[model samples]
Target: MARPNSSPKASISPQKKNSSSPREADFDIQQELSRLQEVIYESFHIPVSRWTIIDEDKVLEQLEFIGTKIPEAIRKALQVLEQKQEILANAEAYAQRIIQQAQEEAAEILDESGIIQQAQHEANQIRQQVQSECEAIQAQTMAEIEQQRQMANGEVEQIYRKSVSEAQQIQEGADEYADAVLTRLEQELGEMLGVVRNGRQQLYNHSAQRQTNNSGKQLSEG
Candidate 1:
């Protein structure tokens, strides 16, 4: 009997399970609601007393527990709603920025169009002024030649030839001036068109860049 001592068995305690997380708590609430609904539907009806017999105390306890969790659940829901609102706000802001940029670009294009119109108007005015001056000079020269012819009938042929030569010179000068002004106007118009084209190209490039950036952002988010 004394030869072998009995080995003592070690007692093991059960580990306490971890409490439910907020997500689990929410799931529990849903389950409880469903169960409460079912219990209500299955409750015994007392026709005589017109009263339903169910586990009132148990239902009240469950309801009390659910009530305690309601504020936390509502708070979480509100947080989600706020996050969605923030995303919507950001999208709206981006849209506004795009609209503003488009408006600015349109304004710039309109300004360029206005400048071109003004240049053309000025060119036309210059042409009209030049034509008027040429006409006035021709008329004055003709008048002077008529006066000289009447004053010296003896030198009529010589005076006629000189007047014709002066008229030809005046005509050539007017033609050369008109040609120079037209050429200058053409060059200016070409330069202005080139500037407008360059501006449009730059705007297109900027828009493409913004689209690329937006696509990259969406891909990253996905």
Candidate 2:
């Protein structure tokens, strides 16, 4: 047997039943308007700075829909904003760090400069001291050399005088020896002359005696 048209036993689809509900239809329309208002506020900071849940059930439905299917451009815009904030923060921190490092390096350079200046001063003092000592040694050596030369000159003068005196004495002794030899030779010549004269006188006397004896013999014989 076919069911009557007026029978209440006929079943409807779940989708159709939901569409027919007045409460559900009103909730869907109101949710769409709330979501539109939310978008406007986010874009322009309009209506107020504080967030308000004007239509709770409606806003909840729209938020759920956005979570599942948001437009690509909106998502991209939000990501760019977040990236820009992070970049600014990093730039600030890096600038502060660079400034601190520069300050430290400057301090170190100043300290090193002071140390170099001190070393230069000390080195200059030492050089001056060494120069003074060298000059003093040179002067002392020159003085000592002069003294030695003076002493040597005095000794040479004394030796020269002594040699002159000794030479004069030796010359006088040689002259006296020459005079003594001449006197002895003159005495020897006088003795030799006397002996020759005596020999001539003897020869004459013998001749005279021979002649007298010959004359006497001749007379007697006659």
Candidate 3:
């Protein structure tokens, strides 16, 4: 003989039967709520602000599903809600902490930016001061070098002029000495010429007298 059709309850899976049990009804409520909170936390936050953007429709869907499952659960949601004030207080404290931390971080970043700008400004001032000092030193060095060069040139010119004057004086003295020696030699040569002329005239006179005497003697004897 053919078997009769079984009831739907008899066809239910063991997993389905366990899910309706008192241990973990359908799913863990805390776990689901945690997932929801995680979803909200993962939302996009605005920069420099604690504002977050969430998906309204998706969040509502998850909440509605969680609410539907609450009645099926054996007062688990009631137990969770029984600590509402404590949960809200903890949430408020957590939000305040996050806001305070964000504000402190923003202030730190602003302070760092200010410090960097201040450092740059001081660096520029130091650079300008160093450049000015270097320029002044260079100008002073150039002036000192120019003054030394002028002094050296003046000394060299003075030495050259003194040497030229000394040389001229020596040349004039040598010319005067040479003229005096030449005058003395001319006088000595003229005196020797006069002595030689006088000796020749005396010899000529003596020879004439001797010849005349000889002629007279010859006549007297004849």
Task: Tell me the lDDT of model 3 at 47.
Answer: 67
lDDT of each: 0.51, 0.40, 0.46
Worst 10 residues of 1 by lDDT: 1-10
Per-candidate RMSD, Å: 44.3, 61.7, 53.8
Instruction: Give the TM-score ranking, best first.
Output: 1, 3, 2
RMSD of 3: 53.8
Question: Better model by lDDT, 1 or 2?
Answer: 1
After superposition, the stretches of candidate 2 with alpha carbons farther than 4 Å from their true spots are 1-159, 218-222
- lDDT, model 1, position 73: 49
Candidate 1's TM-score? 0.37
Candidate 2 local lDDT, 134-217, one digit each (tens):
355345534533543354344433333233343344335333433433343234323433433454455557777888888898
Q: Which lDDT tens digits does candidate 3 get at residues 1-222?
A: 122222222322222223436534345555556556655655666565546677777678778877776554423422332333333334334434443453454344334233334333433443354345435534553453354335444443333324334334534543453344334433532443343345446666878888999999999999
TM-score of decoy 2: 0.25
Best by TM-score: 1
User: Candidate 3 overall Cα lDDT vs. reference?
Assistant: 0.46
